[model samples]
Target: MDPRCIPEKFFDIKETEVLVTRITGGNVRNALQDIHVADALFDLDELAIIHHTDCGTLTWTEEIIRSKVKSFAGKEHWAEIDKTVYGAVADLDEGVRGDVKWVRAHPLITEKLKKGTQGFVFDIESGKVRKIDV
Candidate 1:
């Protein structure tokens, strides 16, 4: 499911335009570049970076995960699963911090999305959302 497509009960806005992209191999920089180009062409307002809990991408290192998948699935699946798990330890605070830092540091998105843009970490256990300090 697209993270942007998820319903927000408390958070209200005029409208939202969803840019659904397949993010694989942990290449967030390239993905943000594509989104940044689209945003510039369209004149977007704000950007939100969302990383969910229990995401499979956080499970293993790129090499280990790829080898396992290749052994079970096929060699073709290696490229798509080559995502390094930097800080996917299920800590809400740490995850949010890492994600926000990554988005803010991205060259394509940094200028467009300044302090106005923000990062949020959602806790499924407590049903709460908190802003992350990048």
Candidate 2:
């Protein structure tokens, strides 16, 4: 969750309207539950998965992070962490596209929400959000 990537400043929308669920690499796979919760509670009009350039996840591999975790958190914790997807995204555009597709394909996500689900890449350097056509 980068502090620079403020949704309201970039999107020019009121804070109350947007449900910003920030996750590592902006992986929608990790956000399915949040979407489900939002869907159950509110009338969600659209869903946007925004990944950013030069993300922290791009810097490390699963093996490296697992090793670090194993060293710090112990073998049992490492094994559990290894079973999880740490959301290490290699390519920003591909990550956004993949997340969008994953979110859209999920059976639990409502049809209307799936239709409205869009992917975008926030350029940390340029301070711009570019929509990725999936």
Candidate 3:
């Protein structure tokens, strides 16, 4: 759902609560690289790693992006970007499960597993959210 489409009253979030999203492949790297998100998860009651079908990030391979980066920013920057894959996945259901596993394995995230984690795939065509088992 476009979260903003619903009024805040529909959910419990308020005051110290927050609703956050990582739109890029729904990668857990955001929490790994960003300390604030890592810290905040401790307070989270649950973490839902959401992804959808036909996401654009799955359009290109890391090698392709690396080659383009080299073409645009010269060899140095491309080398810096190196082997970093942006976690793109062509299979939507597997992708969601993979993200759930990724979050589960992250060091800080593992510490907060008691807070619950799940995967979901939002079907754009059906306007439905289907849960995925990780």
| lDDT for 126 (candidate 1) | 61
Question: Which residue pairs in candidate 2 have backbone atoms (N, alpha carbon, C) closer than 3 angstroms, thus clashing?
Answer: none
RMSD values for the candidates in order, in angstroms, are: 4.7, 1.3, 4.0
TM-score of every model? 0.59, 0.92, 0.74
Instruction: Report lDDT (CA) for all predictions.
Output: 0.55, 0.84, 0.63
TM-score of 2: 0.92
lDDT of 1: 0.55
Candidate 1: which pairs clash? none
lDDT agreement of model 2 with the native:
0.84
- Tens digits of per-residue lDDT, candidate 2, 21-67, equal 87778878887778889888996879988988878988988888777
Candidate 3 residues 11-119, lDDT tens each? 3458556466544766655555443465565556577666665666568777777777677786666657786676656787877777777677766654555348887
Count the clashes in each prediction.
0, 0, 0
